[model samples]
Target: MNHRHLGRSGLMVSEIAYGNWLTHGSQVEKEAALACVRAALEEGITTFDTADVYAATRAEEVLGEALAGERRAGLEICTKVYWPTGPGPNDRGLSRKHVFESIHGSLRRLRTDYVDLYQAHRYDYATPLEETMLAFADLVRQGKALYVGVSEWRAEQIEAAAPLARELKIPFVSNQPQYSMLWRVIEDQVIPASERAGLGQIVWSPIAQGVLTGKYRTGQPLPVGSRAAHEDGARFIAKFLTDDLLGRVQQLQPIAQEAGLTMAQLAIAWVLQNRSVSAAIVGATRPEQVRENVKAAGVKLDDGLMRRIDEVLGEAVVRDPARTASPEKRP
Candidate 1:
């Protein structure tokens, strides 16, 4: 897989990062999850992304076991905080106590001494920004995390934090957002703000939660065991399930055929076309799905093909910057 420098940092991550979000602990069996990680490694993927709250933190344990024998130096392991890992009030947000305590739990679960990057899963409205950055700063000083980033934060939120990160002298490198052919919320505001702040994007849901894969068709039942068929997965993907959107997604099949790419590959390559994107995160339930996504790593779609995609998916894209948001109150 091709690699890119995350933001202006010297650390390089595989362009196609293997992520275990909904699949590792909740959707797929442990053996299946491990097999997918092996497939990723076999395809030369060196970066893996997970979070402390995913599947109540079981995802990290699964990933830890999967990467147990590998040379840690060769892998870029990233995880996040800012979500409730327990029922206690202290269990959530980016308060000093939570951030400090969360990293230890993450480290223990991931089986790593220090993560290459530790990110805020979402902006913490409840905690003071200073307390949050200071906590991350301390982790860096203590050698528990090498770099820090935020996910799904607004442009103004990033702008607000940039100077604080600079003041603290921590390596603030990336913002993980959901960006796909169908989800373009980050393009107008977040990308420009991140560019100014020296933050690259590690985008998730590049295939629009599997909508852009062209598997969910108009006037058809949801695939037997597809993401849309699962209760929790269905909620995140519901917005892209309209007949109008599904019909537009279907029209891209010929474009994929012409480019000798699968619908999923086409979706991934389309996202990487944006220079601000450092990496695209892909999650899989099966090993072959991991293999299929890595093929898009170095593939580039020419201008003509890109235009065709825009034309076909016209008006179906969600570009309103207001959609890039975090909860007003911590959950």
Candidate 2:
């Protein structure tokens, strides 16, 4: 796998990162999850991304067990904070107490002394920005976390925090956003602001929650085993299931065929086309899916193919900078 420096930082991560968001503990069985993790290793993927809140904290344990024997130095293990993992009020957000306490639990669960990157799952509107930044700064000083980043943060929010992170001497180097061919929300404002802040993007949902795979047809019923068929998974992918959007997604088949790539690989390659994107995270339930998605790591799309994608997607694309918003209250 080829590696790229995250933003302007010295850290290098695999171009295709293996992520376990909805798969490890919720969607797939334990054995299946481990098989997928093993597949990622076989494909030379060294970067793994998870979160404290995924599967109510079970995802970390599963990933930990799956990666138990690997050399820790060769892996870039990343997890996030700021989601409610418990019933208490302080259980969520990026307050000093939560950030400090969460890291210890994450370390225990991951079976690692230190994580390569710890991210804010979402911007905490309730906590003072200083408290959150200081908490992350302490993690770096204490050697619990090597680098810090934020996920789903807006352009203005990133701009606001960049100076403070620098002042605290924290290695705040990346942002994790939901970016895909159908979702261009980050292209306008967040990318430029992050470029200025020396933050590279570790984007999620590069295939738009499986929409770009061309499995969900325009007029067909939801595929039996697809994400939209599951109750919990359905909610996350609901926004893109409209008939009009499905029709536009279908138009990419010719492009994928001409490029000698699977629709899934085409979707993944589309996200990596942007230079500022350090890695695109892909979650899988089976090992073969991991093998297919990782093929896009070093693949480049020609100018004509990119323009064809733009033409086919047309008005179905979502590029509103205002869509890069955080919840006013923690869920």
Q: Across residues 132-165, which tens digit of lDDT does each residue of candidate 2 receive? A: 9999999999999999999999999999999999
Q: Total clashing residue pairs per candidate?
A: 0, 0
lDDT of 2 at 247: 92
By summed lDDT, which 10 consecutive residues of candidate 1 come out lowest?
322-331
lDDT of 1: 0.94
Tally clashes: model 2.
0
lDDT per residue (tens digit) for residues 1-331 in model 1: 8999998889899999999999989999999999999999999999999999999999999999999999999999999998899999999999999998999999999999999999999998888999999999999999999999999999999999999999999999999999999999999999999999999999999999999899999888999989999876999999999999999989999999999999999999999999999999999999999999999998989999999999998999999999996888744
Model 2 clashing residue pairs (backbone)? none
TM-score of each: 0.99, 0.99
